[model samples]
Target: MPLFRRRRSATPVPAPGPTPPPPSRRSTEELAAAEAHLSDFARSRPGVEAFIEPRTAVTDTTVVFVAASGEWTRRRVRSPQQAHALARALGVPAYDAGVVGYPQRMREWTRRRAEEDKRRLDGG
Candidate 1:
């Protein structure tokens, strides 16, 4: 026999709480809004092209519409297929961003915008 016997606890240990649900995806309204925005972009910009960006750990699959002027917009899409379909519907040529890569005009446009922003901020 042991010199000292351990005493049992009067109360039972509590079980772990239930697991929380996973985060929900974008809603129908949100998807519609995204589509509308894309349509609007296509209508307003002359010579717009769609580029599909693959999904990443941080972001969902997205489509980027770049105009001839280099102005662009990006929005999350359900999948690459949907992006291509959207491009077709918009009557704009689509390309895989990973394959051909983004156009140089887009970078130049971004740079010009940044300069314009700086000038405005400085009241120049």
Candidate 2:
């Protein structure tokens, strides 16, 4: 089942009024806290680059960090523009993950993880 369900209503939907703030996984405070975390990661991690994943119907835009060794982490940001701005401020280059796709090291890391899981399940 979908995480968010729409309710059936007999009343007609109201016309849009004033613009509303964008929905986010974290509150404003939490997003700001996450920004600090990103900054720390960029400073401590080597060759880290930001990959901005576009938002879909289900979620907000996310910034994924791929280090030189392919280790990665992700956190939700308000939008792609914010992602780019934040990344630049941190002195890192940002790219659209959807457009350029993930780096080869990231893919290799995933493959290694899967292989390790299979080995563990097979008791070898």
Candidate 3:
């Protein structure tokens, strides 16, 4: 007589837990504070050119600044109003990068700056 072995059945897996709620968005005052910080930084930094770009999708908004030698920085803002105010404080023009697009001069400056960095890295 041949002995028969019984196979054990697979256990059912449990469903995933509920997702947590998303973080609350920042208030206008908080956005203003961030703008002020950026504005101050740009003013203190030599040769910085500030620009604002409106966000389309999930991002709130953005303000970007490029220095004379093309080093750059960017931050998310709450609204266009805040961006304009920040630019005014920094004494630099703000534009919608999506609409007006990035300036040709800025692009050229960035390219040249990158080349310079490469040269420095290569010990030229």
Candidate 4:
């Protein structure tokens, strides 16, 4: 004889909401354009490094380049592997943004740019 009896509910559990569609893949032309842009940036900037960002529900995989001056640019790529390959082709070291995070110089540059913009707005 069981000391306690389990109670069962007749109602069924509700289903979860619809899932979001994944980000669309880029066309060949788009990929080429992105590659060209990255190449140009790498060629023009000194001490540039690549940082690969993982794909998310809203965005595809992306690669970011940070130059010595802390100038940066971000562009989407086919995948992390492509990003690393591109970096290698560009002759720059590539790191996982999720692991290493962004460089401090990049933050400093952004802050300086913001300050400059604010000064201009204030007519200084």
Candidate of highest lDDT: 4
Candidate 3 per-residue lDDT over residues 79-102, each given as its tens digit? 678778777776886777777676
TM-score of every candidate relative to the true structure: 0.79, 0.73, 0.56, 0.79
lDDT of 4 by residue, 1-124 (tens): 7899877879977889998756567789998999999999999999999999998868999999999999999999998999999999889999999999999999999999999999999999
For residues 1-124, could you state the per-residue lDDT of candidate 1 as single tens digits? 8999988889987899986643538887887899899999999999999999998767888999999999999998888999999999989999999999999989999999999999999999
Question: Candidate 1, 122: how far from true, in Å?
Answer: 1.3
The candidate with the higher lDDT, 2 or 4, is 4
Give me the overall lDDT of model 2: 0.88
- Name model 3 segments beyond 4 Å from true: 1-37, 45-50, 66-71
- Which runs of model 2 end up more than 4 angstroms from their true locations? 1-22, 117-124
Report the candidate with higher lDDT, 1 versus 2. Answer: 1
Report the number of backbone clashes for model 1: 0
Per-model lDDT? 0.91, 0.88, 0.73, 0.94
Give the range where candidate 4 is weakest over 10 consecutive residues by summed lDDT.
Answer: 19-28
Which regions in candidate 4 have their CA more than 4 angstroms from the true location? 1-25
Better of 2 and 4 by TM-score: 4
Cα-based RMSD of the predictions, in order? 6.6, 9.5, 9.1, 5.0
Candidate 1 versus truth, CA RMSD in Å, comes to: 6.6
Task: Please report the TM-score between candidate 3 and the true structure.
Answer: 0.56
Off by over 4 Å in 1: 1-24
